[model samples]
Target chain A: MVNTSGNVLVVDDDKLICNLLQDVLMRNNVSTMTALNGEEALSIINSSHSIDMVLTDVNMPGMTGLTLMQRIKGISPDLPVVVMTGFGTEQIAVKALLAGAYNFCRKPFDINEITTIVKKGLDLRRNSMREKEVIPFLKVQLHFEIPSDIGFVRSIVNHIQRECGRLGFPEDVFLMRVKLALDEALANAIKHGNKNDFSKAVGIKAEISTKKITIEITDQGSGFDISRVPDPLDPKNLLVEGGRGLLLMGLYMDSLEFNENGTKVKMTKNAQS
Target chain B: MEITTRENVEISIVALNGELDNESAELLRENVEQLINEGKVNIILNFENLSYSNSAGLRELIALYKLANSKGGDLKLCCLQAQIEDLFSFTNLKKIFSIYQDENEAIASF
Candidate 1:
């Protein structure tokens, strides 16, 4: 097995299971930290920097694994989380996978099986990180004149999705989140940032670092006050369908910032650590 | 993607062809939703021409099936290609939907 050289957070309420997993992981040269509940795990994650994987039990006393997954996604969207369940329900496994789990392992798992999965997860993370590093900087510039209508937004999203998928990203949550974030950001650039101006075009550039992915969208129309944008969670905007796009972008992206012009937005997501 | 719809007796058959990736999956969802909205409940998806489907397509199909079931109707599938059949098997969707060997059997069952 390949050594990831990073720590693993094993979260479970059961002390015995935690110790057993720790031992198993240690025997394979994997460093591990144990947390009895989600609260502790979150605290550990916040304090630490090099946690590469999280092996969590689905059912826990407080803050179940699924809830923990959501919180972790909010914090580190690229972190690989493997869920282990004793109940072994297909529906629960499927839901966990859909919610961004790397894989699900049933209780009473074979030691070899867990080891193999862990190796595979680590390899996947390494490969993806390498791909992010190798993503070439935007070289050629292409101008696209898109109407400020909804159809234009859909077409742009479709093209982006196809291009991203063709670039070798897996058809999974990572790609989905990128697609969702781009859709919302591009829509904002067109509708709110550019104010649906047909004369001006949006300039898009993608930059990839060894540890992060950044996308910039700039509109050529009049800008708006970034601080004036209303929060979607506010009760006043509950009935609106458009305000949620910004909220979704914030949730999915690691960092979002606006330039002085206020018509340009840059979104970044760090690759798995 | 190619979509062909046929109505026979009490069932509507929508045949899907080509790859059902993220781009084409939304169109499939809209097509099924439109049929359900038109009060055509008993529907069969003929997959003889479908070559590949990823998770997005599967999710759309599941959503449509649930919508049909909630409306006191059923969604059956027929003539699934080998690659598409493997997807159903891997996801265990074969157990969820009524699968038939051909369109005639599916329509007759409906």
Candidate 2:
């Protein structure tokens, strides 16, 4: 077997799941250690060789997955933790995401999908470690040029969420809000700015600093006149399905700005108060 | 997604026991459309087990509401978890749909 040199801790109550994941991860070139529950996982994490990441289950008998995540955060704050949950357990997934999970997968998950997520977590950790050596403060710039695809947009958001968690940002204040604003902005860029044209591209740029986080999204169409846009709050427009996205962006971010052409939008949110 | 539909005192209570996401929103749309086409439009979507939803799911809900209203029927929701309620509130969707605390209250409201 190839040695990927990435050590992963796999925590699950089910022996079958542990075995399945261990087999899958190992064949993919990564080594793994298995734990039955949160306590067991923490014990391994606290007193073992370096673990590059964690793969955990959300629902356990004694120490829950979320509690395990929190405890893992306490031990190794920057290590990415990927939570695994059963299908239809969306609530648990949401809680896990909010609790700073690097990512999550549904039960009976595909080997390829799990391996890809693990690899991404490993890459993020690698880049973070490198950045720590070079950058003095939290000055991170992530730029992507993607087609107007929802799946790509979601992946970008997930990565940024993990970055925010790693930076120790207040999860309650920023994680969900940032996700919402990004969704709205990206949707608008795709639907309105590019008119859903597959050939057109959307540019996403994110910057994080000690006191401010700024995100800029630019689309490839002629801009609209802000003054001509309907006021969604007006009684006549209350029931309209559209136009709420911009409002949501305005609400969630500390400041919102549009370029002179209005094709590019910028949103800035301040650090925790 | 697990969708359980049953009739309770002339009101159709549809229990959604999964995440409402882009993958499942189309299914939800189809299910509700089937109910509306059958004239079982006065509905209550029971969200006791629902945990998360994305923008695509929200779009489906808005379309479902519009369809129900145009058909001379109404759609109410019940047992929303805190995050789901906050989502509706955030979008001001609470103004369009009547939300109840439980199935009985939602049925009574209609």
Candidate 3:
């Protein structure tokens, strides 16, 4: 185990519990701060990136600990989070662990065991920091397959929105344009290519980084001739509903292309560009 | 999508809230269909609360406009969110739709 001095932010509604944990951690030479609720804890986490770990209770008034942890992960994903729960709420703690909490401890816990867990989590975070420093780029990739139903496309777009937000894409027109382009592409793949057949499926893959995002969408059906698509912008075709998707895709993406078969499309957008 | 409707004399003002995407296009279509079926032709679609939209939504809007126009009652739009306005401008639909900054202007033009 890497025996390094670490900082922990302890979040709980009870003042006495905060004081007790602060006292125990101070004696063990681990620096700590106390937050009365999840909101206060998030304020502290956002202002300082120096916090190595978070020890939070499951239930809080304003924002639940689970939500706070997810928000914290969005901001600094490598930071370790440890959840605490009372005896009856052990299930919540287990759910937290499954959702990426480093570990969970029940209430009225032994101080020694909690201290060891915090120390180990901090060490793992420190090691991750070292690895990130040596790495050239951090890429987040997501892949999804869905039936050829327009109803399911919204969830995929929402997933892309979250990933783009986590990757630091601005919450402005650019983000909306990216989402609109994806929605249009997915609709075309489902409605036109796959013919909305339940047996056919659409595949979507997105690779996001701090620099750029690349999205590829594929369908199971045979493709069409790109030249045959009417230009929606033409005065005669302005009222046409079907051709706008192709035009919008060409306008929104930094670069867009299709495979020779036209069954797949790849779009790239540069971050902050 | 949620549609909140109010009647301004003969004009029906329909305010749309939430996303106007592929999933919710049918809801808007059915709502507009009912409005047209009732012979309420002078309509102003208030887009101030619409958070998002896509081409599918755009298609429905075009179809709705045609339906309203065929009945000799025109469809006007007002209070479009910035991104939706951008979409209109990008597609040059701004020329086709009579858009106003507020409901009063859209109503006065009718």
Candidate 4:
């Protein structure tokens, strides 16, 4: 094991696995921080600046690995992410690789193999960051209005996911996160904003670039204050099933803010470098 | 996906094949839970013919492992394909489940 000054973020729902990985990486002299799930991982990434690489598991209780990857890319597109999977679902792995993962390894991995991959990913990140001329690309814009039909929201998200796949975006996490966020935002627009009106339209705009992707969803209905909504983690709401969607949006999106009208939300995701 | 169950003494072996995705994961979970509830604790998952599995399928497996462990019984895997093995390796799930080279070895362990 060779000592490297780079820091690593290991995100997984399983505590035992987190401990095992911490031991392995620490023994190799790599600094490590662990998060139990994607939401926590995002907070850690946002608050900490010294991280070199992110190693995350694909599946978790609330936010999936693909979703986490998107958030990470939004914050630091140049940072390298390595994904881990326990099931031989090639589609998901292919998705991850496409999303911007430097590399992926299966579970029950050999210690030597993981160490080598981690070292390589860190090296790539370091080299890329050192190059100062990497210009961010133009932001792509996509706008759609919420249809009067309630069932159409799912189709819209599915269509976006398919379109993202066709575009061959460098990271699959972006697609997944966008899809999830789109689903939540659209649902909120239709159900809450439009009050399930089949006639009202919700406007959507997406700005894409090499460095980040920002999307805004606007509803025709009256707007509400985002801050007034109680936190889902409140003690009395612990058993509730519905309040977590907003929390998820806040966690996954780099920034979730509302326009003055309160009917519009502008969310941004930084592109993976 | 297809599941074929065979019982020898008190040990049960569930042979699985085909793709296990969100659509098929529930069936697998229910079948495993039913067996566990029936007091068939020692189990072998014969993966000699399994082709693929997704995150949903992996969740089901984890649930089954937790159930079996709670009952002091173990769930063992046998004859995993290379790609499937890689998935296990990446997720570190291969650490949680006991794997064997063949069904005979897995069944005999109990």
- In DockQ terms, which candidate is top? 3
Question: Order of candidates by TM-score, top first?
Answer: 3, 2, 1, 4
Worst 10 residues of 2 chain A by lDDT: A167-176
| RMSD in Å for model 3 | 5.2
Per-residue lDDT of candidate 1, residues A7-62 (tens digit): 78999999999999999988888889999999999999988877888999989997
Residue pairs in clash, model 2:
none
Docking class of 2: incorrect
All candidates: TM-score of chain A = 0.56, 0.53, 0.61, 0.49
lDDT for each residue of candidate 2 in A135-225, tens digit (9 for 90 to 100): 4366778898999776576688787777766665557656556677787788788878998888899999998765567999999988888
Evaluate model 4: give its TM-score: 0.38
Against the correct fold, how does model 1 do in TM-score? 0.42
Q: Which of the two candidates, 1 or 3, achieves a greater TM-score against the reference?
A: 3
- Given candidate 2, what's the lDDT at residue A246? 76
Per-chain TM-score of candidate 2, chain B = 0.95
lDDT of 3 by residue, A24-81 (tens): 8888888899999988998999898789999998888889989989988898878899
Reference contacts preserved by each model: 0.00, 0.15, 0.70, 0.00
Candidate order (DockQ): 3, 2, 4, 1
Candidate 1 on B11-82: residue-level lDDT in tens? Answer: 899999886755687899899889889889899999999876654566678788889988888999999877
The predicted structure with the larger lDDT, 2 or 3, is 3
Q: After superposition, how far is residue A233 of candidate 1 from its true place, in Å?
A: 36
Ordering by lDDT: 3, 2, 4, 1
Local distance difference test, each candidate: 0.76, 0.83, 0.88, 0.77
Q: Best candidate, TM-score-wise?
A: 3
- Which of the predicted structures, 1 or 2, would earn the higher TM-score when compared with the native? 2
Per-candidate TM equals 0.42, 0.63, 0.74, 0.38
Error of 4 at A247 (Å): 0.6
